[model samples]
Target: MNSLQDALYNWLTIKVVIDERPDDTAAVETEKTFYDMLKDDHSLTNIEVTKDDEMYYVHFDHEGERKKQRFPRELIEVMLNQINQQPERYRNYPI
Candidate 1:
């Protein structure tokens, strides 16, 4: 994979692992990885992802103000499907 694809796969892998095992010992490092990926890939800082019953919420700072966005669970599921199809792409992620 190219650098961008590799980075995205790694980031998504970290997100999935954190969601599945929030109490894992690698949580802190995974969070750092997530944040770094957001900054590098999307120019976003202070990023956080959270999920409720139906949506995934992304919170971040933009222009010195806090902003939030919601993504439907189905959209995330589509991304997860793509990730699952190429599991080897994500194998190098820490944790």
Candidate 2:
């Protein structure tokens, strides 16, 4: 993915990778939202959903270089603020 989206997606996770596979990057994540995917999909994001525990740790692999990334709580807050700011995004939409 492009760097901008990468920068955004990076700010949400825990652990290097849910499942370290040979075919995949060492840091991996599930396909579902972090809230649901925490337990069933992958071992990541197992922390309780609180303001204190919002910060997440993740791993990124770009150009064969794998590095650790910390998804700060601030980024999450920004997202939350964005969602809160845009009421239209959720109007009549599935929760």
Candidate 3:
């Protein structure tokens, strides 16, 4: 997967773990994994993820310019659906 898709897959995986085990400290590590994956992209810096009532916002610097991308809930769901079709691509178990 490309960097963005990899980051989102990690985000979704950790989110499921967080929801299942809210008190698990290891979830923090999984969250960091998402950021670290994004940071590995040479073109991106200062990456951040935020959410409001309806959308997720990804902010970063690309090639020294600031940029942001918004992903609607439906878009995320669509990605999740696609991911579900090939669980082994992102995770060892079903998300």
Candidate 4:
């Protein structure tokens, strides 16, 4: 299934925004885990995690210099699977 969307997802900046609960540590940790995995392995950039008030945003810069993209996970599973498959593709993005 080499659809264009799948290919785009490979090189897209994925931004995930999630609501927080009283104890959001696990959620934050999970997001961090994803970011670290992507950063160390793939060419993804700007993998940032930010929290404001009651919301959290995890954003990564897209894979190419000519184009920048942000990806919000439709669900955690799909995004993680994509990231896992091409882990080495997400590293050292040019500034």
Candidate 5:
């Protein structure tokens, strides 16, 4: 498959939120882990994560435009774990 096909077939859906308040130690750590996974995963592109006032913002580019989504702090860890723990059968296949 080529880039177009890869982009067309590849999809990533996540729940995230935005808050202005500073995050606690645990939340901060989860954020770090989330970012670490993003960095380690080369298949991800045009992704952004930010937090303020307890709200977390997650965004990534799809097709030609950027898309955004929100998720609560409590659920970020869960989402992170889900992404990190994707089963071998669900992982992207090399073209």
Candidate 6:
């Protein structure tokens, strides 16, 4: 992968949405799993996870430039998988 893809994969933030269901333990567990896996694997310096009425946002720095990428909250897992398996798919991020 190129430098942009590499940097993004290494440090991008994954904003996850928390479902407001009292019995949605799976969502909570998923959020924790995602956070732990990313932290352990990437050692990111800018991990911001929040749950509000906003869409998913991925923020990162490439070289000396800060960038952001947005995604639907429901696509969190898909987005993460793509980031890991196909970084090229996000070459135009921040556009």
Which candidate should be chosen as best, given TM-score against the real structure? 3
Clashing pairs in 6: none
Q: Model 2: runs farther than 4 Å from truth?
A: 1-36, 44-46, 52-71
Candidate 3 global TM-score: 0.52
Candidate 3 lDDT tens digits, 1-95:
46675565556556545554455456656766666666765456876767787887778887779888776755555544554576566453333
Question: For residues 6-85, what per-residue lDDT tens digits would candidate 6 score against the true structure?
Answer: 43332333322233222335444555665555445544446443334555566644345556666455444554465547
lDDT scores in order:
0.61, 0.39, 0.62, 0.44, 0.44, 0.45
Choose 3 or 5, whichever is better by TM-score. 3
Writing each residue's lDDT as its tens digit, candidate 4 over 1-95 gives 34433434443323231232213344445546545556555555665455455443445565654333334444423544554577585332322
What lDDT does model 5 reach?
Answer: 0.44
Taking all chains together, each candidate's TM-score versus the true structure is 0.47, 0.32, 0.52, 0.35, 0.35, 0.39
Q: Which candidate is the best by lDDT?
A: 3
Please write out the lDDT profile of model 2 over residues 1-95, one tens digit for every residue. Answer: 23533533532432222221212222232323342433333333323222247565555443455445555666645534554577476232222
Is 4 or 6 the stronger prediction by TM-score?
A: 6
What value does the lDDT take at residue 31 in candidate 2? 23
lDDT of 4: 0.44
Q: Say which prediction, candidate 3 or candidate 5, comes out ahead on lDDT.
A: 3
- Per-residue lDDT over 13-88 for candidate 5, one digit per residue giving the tens place of the 0 to 100 score: 2223112212334434444555445435424457766756655566766556777666555544454465357635
User: What is candidate 4's TM-score against the reference?
Assistant: 0.35
The CA lDDT at 56 in model 2 is: 56
Candidates 1 and 3 compared: the better one by TM-score is 3
Q: Rank the candidates by TM-score, best first.
A: 3, 1, 6, 5, 4, 2
